[model samples]
Target: MGFTAMGLAQNSISGVIKNENNEVLSNVEVLVSDAAIQTKSNENGLFELKNLPIGKITLIFKKENFEIKSEEIAIGKQEQKIMVVVLEEEAHHIDEILVSSIFNKTQNENVVKIDHINLKNIQNEGAINLSDAIATNPGVNVVSTGVSIGKPVIRGLSGNRVLTYTQGIRLENQQFGEEHGLGLNANGQESVEIIKGPASLLYGSDAMGGVLFFNPEKYAANNQTEFSVNQVVNSNTQGSNSSVTLKTSEDKFKFLVQNNYTTHADYQTPNGETVVNTRFIEKDFKVGTSYATSRYVADFRYNYNDLNLGLPEEDIEDARFRTPLYPSQKIENHLLSFNQKVFFKNSKLEATAGYVFNNRKELEAADEVALFMKLKTFNYNVRYYLPDFGKFETIIGFQGMNQENRNFGEERLIPNAKISDIGFFGTSQYKMEKSLLQFGVRYDFRIVNIHEFGEIGTEGSFQKLDKNFESINASVGFKTEITEKITSRINIATGFRAPNLSELSSNGVHEGSNRYEIGNPNLKNEQNFQVDLNVDYNAEHFDFFANGFYNSINNYIFIAPNGNTIDDNFVYDYLQNNAALFGGETGIHLHLHEIDWLHMTSSYEMVIGKLDNKMNLPLIPANQWKNNFRANFNVSKNIKNSFVFLQANYTFNQNNVSEFETKTGNYLLLSSGIGTDIELKKSNFNVYLTATNLLNKEYIAHLSRLKADGIYNMGRNIVLGVNFKL
Candidate 1:
């Protein structure tokens, strides 16, 4: 019987349906268990079921190529209830859909080690940037100049070896520099996924080290429009961040837009002293739209970012503002992309194309531009899923990129160059009841052309230079269930990386790093072979995991001092050698079913990088241990989802160092936070307060570029954040 017959108030439930990548899925069937209510999602992946009784009920969501999701929801006396539902692709089905090359299977079924971080869970963890959020995962670290600049380091590798993808496009914004950040904002992102092993078979050159994938936020439910505002304030840097987002969806179209701005002053140290010129200002805007049907899907996205970064100087005047002085940099980036998917009766095809333009200018004086460069890149990819043959699922893909770099300033670092790449790959997976086997192979070719330029200083002018590189890579992996509670994965992969433009043509001092760098035109491609193993065990109240990897690289490139001086600066030249790196991470989570609100977790990670001569590599992160205790509770009728957490982090002394690096002492850090969701009249809000480095500890990190200047990391920081929805 309907609620109207009983004279009871009718409530409505509405929500959006999405995949693991946060992309909307259309044609989904939404049904209420033990009821006659049923509905189908529209092209925007939005669904609604109205005229429901005020009670607890189960909602089932099912679609082709995706796993069926069932959620139990409580309907109050309110007129409407809004929700966001996420569905994962089915890996064991004949019509499985691929979210990404790294996340093709479930976490337990994948051969490689992958970690996922939900932004909502860590929003109150005192993270200021995307890198900060990612660092919470085991075996993941950050190389930083200061709080304003950070780069992700997976295992023990970074720089050109690590690849980042957003909006289904590879990001290229002069990532070869040590002082450059990721050029992305943490706002408007749903989650982040990290692949800790070689992924060159899927992403080509830069995937030799690892891959970082950012998932965008989903659209609003059908016939609904919503907006949100978020604000954050930090005491350490006197920083303020604000962002706003608006999303809406109709029957066949969905749109989302967001804008964010951040400003900060010099960060203070534990000793009550501020680090001068360590401030930055950033502005970002993003817009996206999607259209989906039963036969085809189309998506478009654009992002614009502007940054003003300060260069650290010794003995500079301290101020609580972000006005960059001399020797600063201004960078602007624009990215546009379009993606399409076609579904047939028994097969599917996907295509994506993207373009990025980066403009960077460095000022050494009030009115003079020392360095100005522009980088333009175009990327394209296509993949086709073939019909299932017997018990195997296969995919064939092609990917390529065309890039150009131009200089327009007085100082020239690397010559103008054009780069082109092409690659072809195929992969297959066989799924069984107790075991899964996966393998893939790829071949890539690259060409680089450099234009001649006049010589400067002791470096000779570059003649017309042309180079070509080719590589064949492959990977084989297996996942098996040993018992009802244990699982294991074993993988062997080969990856390669071509030398970047700076490593091939630099001829002068890099002012940002305060070192004279020389390039090696004769350098060859770096090749690596690695083996990874992962073991996992799960019980009713306990979870444990261990991951290990060993990598060997031929022709590994590094910069070394040549025992010479250029204008009072030490001269460093790029060199190549055979190198090896081995590392492992382990963690355990304990929860008591009797006390479901209490949880305890601990983890440890260690890595070592060495050359063929037994010399350690520079900038390797120190071994670290982390432990956390959290409690969840409800305060009263007006407050819910309340939680308190305490965290302890300890870093072991780094005694293993390169000849050019120094050892760092061990230290410990303490952090804590509390947050809750508040219910108001016709609205809801979230508030959080976090304290980092609660003890005001002073410490130096091994991977911190500022360590050379005897500078300590940021001191105690108190952060407050609030979110409002309308």
Candidate 2:
């Protein structure tokens, strides 16, 4: 239970190692870089290193089937510190893993471009939703109807083209709707990994654009119990959010539970105008349990979410409540999943099954429901890993899903439909001394069937429709270290997406987007081919990275206006054409080694999307540049990790417009924040104060759906948050 001393008046470090699942990991190797002090964790996942220099030092943790983790610490004279270290499971090397990539490899080794967002950093930014949190990443954007409704857009693609996965299952919460958010809460989530390009080789259809993978929080360590309470308050909308989480683990069983509630009033514009029907309320609950043994492991999770969201298309005089008025939506979602893994000597078999139910109702008047839809989805996946032979490792997998959509309200925008999908894929990786190569291929088949209702040839009736689609997708990539300080990766991949129900069957006015829409039953699957290149350089004081991509799509589907209107709403119809997109992102990080507590970072991103006729795509984000300066300071014993940061974001004028879209002007915004961790008795607290839009600028984002309505985005706002751990 103690470190063996090698000298007098020496410092010591003791810690425990746990895997991403929060399970205690034994036999983990802990080492001091460039030092002779090294030890392995015991059966209880505890290790100690004694007689260490009383200065700055770095510790490295390594284990089989897990990514190597490194942490830096500062030790005082004759100081004894206890630490807790967490190791992420290697996506490509672990027996059972959930990742966006096909092969288990670190970010530096993966050929495909990927980005990771730490939730702690997002929380510090005072993000209101998951989309807002992820928007900080380069090459990612968000499309929003209002503050309460936002969806992630990768490059220039969104909606059905992008896929979202949680708990190792594809989320099926009626994503085909234009105004639907991701339907996920930010609490109880550990981190997010974004694949910024086509990823159909691992995930099947609907990944023609990219993928957003959310990893759930891990359980507590063995024989450990922990609880936390968090609260956040926002000024712009007079909003408040509170959450509580409890986790405990025994010898072989681990459990976790979390509950969160959020309520917000109508958001105020920079011009001091209140946009009515912008208020919302949400409740989320999550529970998970896992049991593990040497040869078998089982895990189960369940999540429930209820939301009351308002749809604001026009400005109203009185808007300051938390309840939705007329023209609002009540949505309820439930997700349940179970996963099993069988571990062999050198290979593993993993199976996962999930079910999701989504109920959505749109109320146009008090006690009257105008639109209601129920969606049910069942999905399953199985993957088998073959024993590694030499330097080659292979995995084969199969995935399938069945979905049904039904309506029970007075009006229906889309017909009742049933959809089925099945796909098979195989991927392999070869590792060399300084290079890694990966390749994968997949085949997918989908079927859609629409039921007939009312009369066959009436405006309010629909005829029976059946459609089938089949596609073959493939990908190949390579990662190589060009020199001791530079690395490069190149990837070429193909993706496809089947036409969604709204695109193939819609025949009426949609109130959500305020458009009269028609569908094309003969639409084909959209296909895309993309090539990506990434280069990076890492030195002692500086790090730099550049990413570029070119994508070409065939049979691209879009809704185009036909110069007509129905009941004062613009009329649009689904159409197909050839399109292309090209973009790149570059960034640099400079570490002030001499000062050791100062840093500077900057990045720029640009993208362009157009059809074959040279017409620009609608709703594309404008080019942007971001810069940040941060300073870290040493504090007293009661305070830890104190820091302050200043940031500036500039968006260029978006002159590129489609035939029916208007141009948007440019704007700049400034933000700053300060935070610190406090220790009191046996408990700890994290407190932060953040200010956004410090200049109180009035501007409209080019991608905002409210831009056409002449409504500005949120203005200056202050946020205060605190977390107490017990």
lDDT of 2 by residue, 1-726 (tens): 112223235467787888767788886877653232456788889887665444445566777546677665655556677777888854322112225566544476566768877677687877888898888888888998778888898998888888999987999998888767989989988778899889998889999999999878777655568799999999998999999999886645779999999998888888898878888899999999977643556789999999899888654445447888778899999999898876555666889899999999999877899989999999999999787879888999999999999999988877899999999999989989999899999999999999988766554465689999999999999989999889999999999999998888777788777888888899999999999999988776687989999999999998899999878988899999999999989998887567657778889999999999899988788999988887766488778778899989999999998877789999999999999889897789999999888888999988888888888988888889999987
Q: Residue by residue across 1-726, what tens digits does model 1's lDDT show?
A: 012122224467777888888888876878654233456787898877765444445577877446667665555544576678888764321211124543255465566657777676776899877887788889989999888889999889998989999888899999988878899888877778787878898899989989998766666655467788999999999899999999886655778899999998888999988888888899999999877543556788899999898889775665547786567789999989898876555566779999999998988877899889999999998988786788787889999999999999988777899999999999988889988899999999999999988854455355567999999999999989999889899999999999998899888888878888899889999999999999988776788999999999999999999999988999999999999999999998887778757889899999999999999987788999989999877789779779899999999999999988999999999999999889786567889999999999999888888999999999999999999987
Give Cα distance to truth, residue 306, candidate 1, Å: 0.6
Q: List runs of model 2 lying over 4 Å from the truth.
A: 1-45, 48-98, 315-320, 456-460
The clash count of every prediction, one per candidate, is 0, 1
What is the alpha-carbon lDDT for the whole of candidate 2?
0.83
- RMSD of every candidate to native, in Å, equals 7.9, 8.1
